[model samples]
Every structure is written in structure tokens, then in C-alpha cells.
Target: MIDQLSLTNFKAFRSADIPLAPVTLLTGLNSSGKSSVLQAFVLLRQSYDSSTLFSSGGGLLLNGELVELGTGLDVLHEDVVHTPGLPTPLISIGLRTSEGQNFNWSALYAAEQDVLTLHSASDAQRTKSVFDRRRFQYLKADRIAPATSYPKSHHQAIGLGFLGASGEHTVNYLRHHARRPLTSKPLRHPKAQTNNFLDHVVAWMQELCPGVNLEATEIPGIDAVRLSYGFDGTAGLTSSARRRPTNVGFGLTYALPIVVACLSAGPGSLILLENPEAHLHPRGQSRMATLMAAAAAAGAQLIVETHSDHVLNGLRLAVKNGAMSATDTAVHYFRRRGLQAEIVTPRIHEDGSLSDWPEGFFDEWENSLEQLLD
Candidate 1:
């Protein structure tokens, strides 16, 4: 699990060190640097797993160039100069495990020289060190390609593969997992919950979309497995409603990856998500938040960027319901100025309420009042 992340000359941040928790929520106004935080993780994951990061054409584009590293901080555009005399841009990330193990890595760019360098605590003492940017996996929202029909041979093999940031392959991932049965005794979290991770996920999804039953099936001629969600209906209902994956709504399709990722993630895996609440109604968004908190409680660390208060409230409800401990979650708010962004930590209460509601924190009523008064 990641415990800290520090950014220097990375996008809207000149220098900032942000702490993390099992489940971390990033919320802010438009252009307030919420996306930058998610982008930083994508870049870090690309440094480790380039193939997955660049699988889709919509992946990261630095200054219109597809260069992976040492491409400079121009990736994060700014209108003002920071530190007047600084010569390079830097981005560093720190990760810690439950056992207190720590890993520190950084990337540096010199715009004038058009050179970039990757650094890490493992090589801090050396003058020059070789950097290998293939140790992590990344997914970005824009890079997610919808699953589509193609030649049966074109189907990708499944194992421990990557899911894009937008959760494009969520349905596929869940379908793959549903076919495999427990090889060992069902794994349980510290809290001794009766259901395993995958069971809990399916339960939550059922709660969100009632009358739907998910299962995995193998095509007669195709080697690939497919996930199907059957809708409980009368025999006279349309064929689509009686089918599997085809019968489910798009919201369930979009939410599948998040559920699969959390259930499949191991102790050390790092999951980065941007607005996991997209495309869902307020109730569904809240349910998604609860699932995320449950994932964190089960031991997978999550870093999420969201603007929905419904998602936030859902997490609080999870805490209040004892699904997750308050100490295991944290909320960070970002506010952008001309060139820099400010990060604030909000206090979460036992009742799952926020201690301080910042100005404009989902204040649509205030905007309406101003219009009425004027």
C-alpha cells in the first residue's frame, strides 16, 4: 500500500508531499488539480508497465509527444513561472507497506537541456544510475477503450492483467474471475467477514442493481470466457433481458472493473482511480463508495479522485456501519491558483460526516440563492 506521494514541478504542483490511507478520496473544483494527482499515478505506473499504460491510443500524451520518460514537466502546463531560478522539473513518489517497508522514486527533467532522469532511494548515493520504467501498472480514463466485438482469435488472454483507469474492461475482468473457483480456503480480512472479497463484491453489485444475477460462461467455440448478468423476469420478456452481460445496464458494465480490481488486488497492489462514480445515479454512486471502502478494509490500498458528494457520503456511511475504520480513510481537497494548487485534509467524524465543509463544497444551494437575490 502507498503511504505518501510527493510532487515537485509536476503539473499544478511545484512541491507538495501528500499522505495516504487505505482509501484516499481526492475532491476539488474544476481545474483544481484533482486530475493531476491521478495523472501522477498514471505516470508512475507507466514507468513500470508501459505496455498496459499505452495499450490504448488515448493514453498519456506529453506535449503532443508519446515519449515515456525524461520528456520534461511540460506535460503539466502552467501560465506562471515557479521558483524563478529552478532549472528542472521533478516528481517523486513514496510507498509504504503494512510492515513499514518504504520505497522512494523520483523523475527529473531539464527543459532547457531537453533531458530527463529517473531517481530512486536505492541509487541516491550513485552519481549516475540506470532507470528501468517497467515495474508498475497504470490506467488512465481517456485511454480506456470500450470492449467490442472482433475476430474470436483477437481475444486477449487473461491472468493478472491490467484494467484501464476508466474501468473499460471491468465486465471482462469480472467474467474471468467468476469462472475460477477458490483453490484454497476462502481468504478473509482481519474483521472475519463471512464472505470473501469476491463474494462481497457480487453482493454489493446485487444491492445496487437488483434482479440481476451475474455468472461466467464459456462460449462453445471460443476460448475466451464471458460474463453474463441475468435479469429476473417473466418468460415472455425480451431475449436480452434473459441473457447474461447483455441484459445489464451500462452503469454495471462501467463499475465492474472497480469491483474486480478490489477483490483481485493483493496486499501490495496500488489501485488508482479517477471519479469511480461516473455514469451512475446518486444512489449507485453512494453504493460504489461503500464497496471501495470495503475493499480498503480488506487490505488493498486505493487512491481515488472524485467530485461527487454522494460518493463521499457513502464512504462515511461505510465507516459508521463498521465496514471500515475512520482512521483507514482520508479525504484531500485541492484548490488551484494561477500556477499552484493547495491541498487540504478534511476531518472525518465517527458518524461519517465531515468536520469542516469548505466554501463551495457542493454548495449548489448557495449559487441558487445568489441568483434569486440578484
Candidate 2:
């Protein structure tokens, strides 16, 4: 899991070192640098997979252009309109094992010099790398930009460790993995729970459209597997009712990726998500948060960027209900001061309660009172 992330010359962050826990929640106002934290991780992962620093052109691109990596001191401000010459916009991430082994990696770009560099902790050497950086999966709100292909399009097989950000191929991935036994490896889920997992996914959809069941079957002429949601009437149904993903409500499609991704992620895998609660009802959002908490408990590291109070409350409830440990969770709030942003970590108690409530921290009452006072 990521133990610490230090940003220098990255967007909104000049120089900041934030500690990370197993399950970290990043909450803040829009553009307060919350998303940048997730972006930093995505970039780090991309660095590992890329052959050159700016080659792959994946998540690192912002607004259809490469992200400018400024010098470290450039982001720091001495006072209004007075800033020191910045250092290279270098980003460093510190990772530690449960046994306390630490690994640090850094990346930067020099526009004037037209060069990008990547450095690893153990290796004293710095080298220019390509865009095809390391393999790090991310689920952002605007997952892949308009020009990029679907995340899974590059993969030949359906379930070989490929999960798209939009989770487009989620159902297909699940179906493909479910059919084959992993080679010489014990199945992770018990038969009963595996069945329950499928049932739960379909059942959640059924709430929106009753009597629905998801089935994975090969098309008559195609080699690809497809998922179809079937609906039936009461007992002794008259006709078979089924629909493609396009026909069902988007919520079903949106929630599918989150559920499948959580179930599929193993230890040491990093799952970065932006607003998993999007398109979900309050109840469904709460349930989704619980699912994520469970994944974290099972050793998958999750960093979620969310704007949902329901999601936060659900995580707290999960901790209270023994679904997650308080120690495994960290809630960081991003607050902006002029051009710089500050991160505040909230303390979660043993009983899943918050120790401090910062101003404007999901408090609707403040808005209500302001309106009245105004």
C-alpha cells in the first residue's frame, strides 16, 4: 500500500507530503486538489509501465496536453506575487510493506529542456522513460478521454488482469473468470459465496427492474462472451424477458464495474476510484461503499475520491458493524487557500465515529443557516 505521497510542482500541489493508510478517503471542494492526489498515483503507476516518460499518453494528459512538471520550489509561495524559482516538478511516492520495507519513486518533466525523467528508490540511476509506463489501473469520473480507446480493447483475453476505468467490460470479465478454474490455484471465493456474489449483483439490479437474472453465454457466431440480463414474470412465467446492457438503467452498468473490480482485486493491487457513488441511489451508494470497505479489509488498497456524504457515512457504519477496521481507514479533506491546497486528515474512532468535524465538512446546516442569515 502507498504509505506516503509527496508532490512537487504538480497541479495545485506545490510541495506536500501526505501519509496514506490502507483505505483512504479524499474529500474536498471542487478543484481543491483532491483529484490531483489520485492523478499523482495514476501517474506513478503509469511511470512504471511506460517505456519513455511521456510516451503512452494515458492518464497523464490533462486537457489534451501533457501535464507540466514544474520545479519543486516553483509551487511554493513566499507571499502575494512573490515566489522563488521552482525546482523540477518532481513527484515522489513512498510505498512500504507491512513488514516495513520502503520504496520510493519519482517523476518529472522539463519543458524547456524537452525531457522527462523517472527515478526509483533502490536504483540510484535516473533515466528517460516512454509513455507506456507501468500498469496501474484507475477508475476516474472521466475515465478515458474522448480520443482514447476502451481500456480493455488492448487485451486479447477477457479476464487476464484488465479492468477499465469506466468498468466497461466488468460483466464480461466476471463471466470469463468465473467459467475457468485458475491454473493450480484455489478459487478465492467459496462456491456458496461465489453464487451469492452473482446473485447479489443480479438482485441489486432487480430492485430497479424486478425478476432479472444475469447470464453469460457465447453468441452464435462470435467468440466473445456477452452478459444479458433476463427478466421473468411471476411463477410459471409466460415469456422470456431479457435486455442488453444498453437497455437497462445506467445505474446497473455503472455499479457493475465497482462490484466486479472489488471482488477481483488481490493484495498489492491499487484501485483508484472517483465517485463510485455516481448514478447510484443513496441506499445503493451506501452498499457500494460497504463493498469497497470489504475489499480494503481483504487487503486491496483503495483510494476513493468522493463527494457523497452517504458514502462516507456508509464507511463509518461499515467500521461500526465490523465490516472494516478503523485503523485501515483514513479520511483526508482538501481545502484550498488561494492557489495552494491543504490536506486535513480526520480521525476515526474505534466505534466508527469521527473525532473532529472541520468547518464545511459535509455540513448542510452551515449552508442552511447562511441562507437564513443572509
Candidate 3:
């Protein structure tokens, strides 16, 4: 997996080298560059998927399916650095693997152009291994809400195994892969009856809303799929009828893609999540963290951006509970200094306690209590 990501003259970072682990949690205030890190991964993968990064006229496509970064000027660091005589500073992105191999891509700056031409290298093997759509999944913060039907793209869902950046194809993908065996023991929810993917999903969702179960089915004569939810003994109901996603409310449908993504984990899988805790209750958010840790223990590498302390505490709980090795996790607290983003890394101990907690790093609860007492 990506052991480290280096950004030079990229958005929100003049120069930054961010370390990654089996499960890396990016947490910080709004606009503090947490999402920018995930965007870089999507940017590279999007460029590669469109064949723009490796073609003869190589370039980084700023606007693509996964992200829309606009012109080079929009992403170029305001305080760009360059050689004394150089008029322009190139935007460079570097990915270093755990095996010590480095894949670098640099693009020339253009004021208004969307595609920035690149100075490419023949590191195709390593690059493909990192960005190949089949092994990668990116779920954006603005995910698909409750919908009657979701798009079904065979190439994206079944062929590439992508749930889509906004999870627009999740229903279709879920329907197609429902029966697939979940061989990752760590990812299999204990309460799940069967070893199939769908049952595991229900068992996980049941944590948020007890007795909640969902299904994805194809719509005949259309290139779409529908997702529905049902409850058993929830709110004193014996067995509720399958209802459209619209009727079940936002949290369940909104969190479905994340559940499916984590369950899809396996050796060499790379999942980039933006706010996996969004719209979730306190307990649900924390449970999401445990689910992610399980994904890491199952051999997938996950880079998650979240703002919930419950998610943070859940991760600590996982480490302490032996769900994953403490060494396998990294907690980064991000905050802006002037115009650039600064990151502080805290080590996770065997006891699930942090080695450091910088100011404004998930300390609001205590901070607020102090004020209340005063």
C-alpha cells in the first residue's frame, strides 16, 4: 500500500510528506487539508483511468469522474517554491511504497488550463499496482442520498468492482456481488448468519439500527438497480415490509456504501474514505471505526478522513481490544498554519492510548466540560 504521500506545490500544502499505515485516520478542522490528501489519491487514479497520465502527451486531468480540481492555478500552492531563476514551479506528487519503490509524477503549471502536462517516467508497473481501479475505491464526502434507484454500469460495478465516487453504483454493485463469499475472517460480522457479503452487510448495519436489513435488486428493462430496507422487531414491529431507500431515512442509505466498501476488503485493497462517520449517531460512528480496523486486519489498507471523536475513540478501543496491532494504525491531527497545512502524528500505544494530543485534537469534549465547570 502507499506507505507515504509527498506533495510539492499542491493544494493546501507547499511541501508535505504524510506517513501512512495499514489504517490511517486523518482528522482536523474544516478546510485544514484532510480532504485534500484524499483528493490527491483520487487525482492520480482519475488521471490514470482516463489514460492521460501515461499517454505520449501526458498530463494530469484536474477534472474527472472522481474529482474536479479545476485549473492548475486552483490547485497550485499560493506560496510555490522554485529554483531562483525558474519562472514556474512544477506541481509534484510522490508515492513511496512500503517496499521502498517511489513513483513520482510532476506537472507543469498552467494558469487557466485544466490539464497540466506532465514530466512522466516509465514506472508503469508500480504506478498501475497503486492506481488500478480494481484494487482501489474512493467514496467522496457527498455520497448518494436516499434514492429509488441507482445506476448500473457493468464495466464499473461488476468488471472494475467500483462502487463509484459518490456510491452512485452501489445498489447495482451490491446486487451483483451479494452472494460473493466473504473469506476475510476479520471482516465477517460475528452476528451474520451466512458467509456471504450481503448477510455481513446486514449484520453490520444492524449495529446502527437494530433489526435493519437491506437488499439490492435489478429493475427489469432498465440499466439500474434498486435498494430497499426492512426491519425485524425494530420499534416493536414483527417484520416490516421492504421499503424504498427514500422511506428508511438518510443514515442507512448514506452509510451503505461504506459498509460494502469495508466488507470488500482483502489483501492489497486500497480504500480512501471521506467522513465515514457522517450522519451517524455516536455509537454508530464508533462502530464504523471498529469496522474499518477490521478491514485493516483483513489485509486492506484504509485511509479515512473523519471529524468524529467517537470514531477516534472507537479506533482506540479497537487497538486496546486487539482487533489490530497498534503499530498498524496512525492518527494524524491536521491544522493550518498561515496558508499551509501542518500535520501532527500521534503514536498509538498497545493500550490504545495516544502518545500525544496536540491542541484542538479531539479534545473538545474535555475543553467544553472545563468551561461548563468554570
User: Could you say which candidate leads in lDDT?
Assistant: 3
RMSD of 1: 6.3
Q: How many angstroms is residue 21 displaced in model 1 relative to the true structure, after the best TM-score fit?
A: 0.9
**Candidate 3, residue 235: CA error in Å?**
1.7
TM-score of 3: 0.97
Q: TM-scores of the models, in the given order?
A: 0.75, 0.75, 0.97
Alpha carbon lDDT at 205, candidate 2:
48
| Residue pairs clashing, model 3 | none
RMSD of each: 6.3, 6.1, 1.3
> What shift in Å separates residue 294 of candidate 2 from its native position after superposition?
1.3
Using lDDT, rank the candidates from best to worst: 3, 2, 1
Per-residue lDDT of candidate 1, residues 92-133 (tens digit): 555544456555655445553232355333332331111122
* Per-residue lDDT of candidate 3, residues 1-374 (tens digit): 77999998999999999999999999999999998899888888888999998888788899988899999989999998784555778888889999998989988889899999986554676567777567788999999999898998999899999989998888888898899898989998989989999999999999877889888999999988888888886765545577888887889888999999998877899999998888889999999999999999888999999999899899999999999999899999999999999999989899989998899998889999999999
Across residues 83-187, which tens digit of lDDT does each residue of candidate 2 receive? Answer: 235353454444455555555554454443322455323332322221112223467674322111122333522524556655655545666565443221111
Q: Name the lDDT of candidate 3.
A: 0.89
- Give the range of the ten consecutive residues with the poorest summed lDDT in model 2: 126-135
Candidate 2 Cα outliers beyond 4 Å, as residue runs: 53-93, 112-115, 119-136, 143-159, 180-212, 220-225, 231-239, 369-374
lDDT for model 2: 0.60
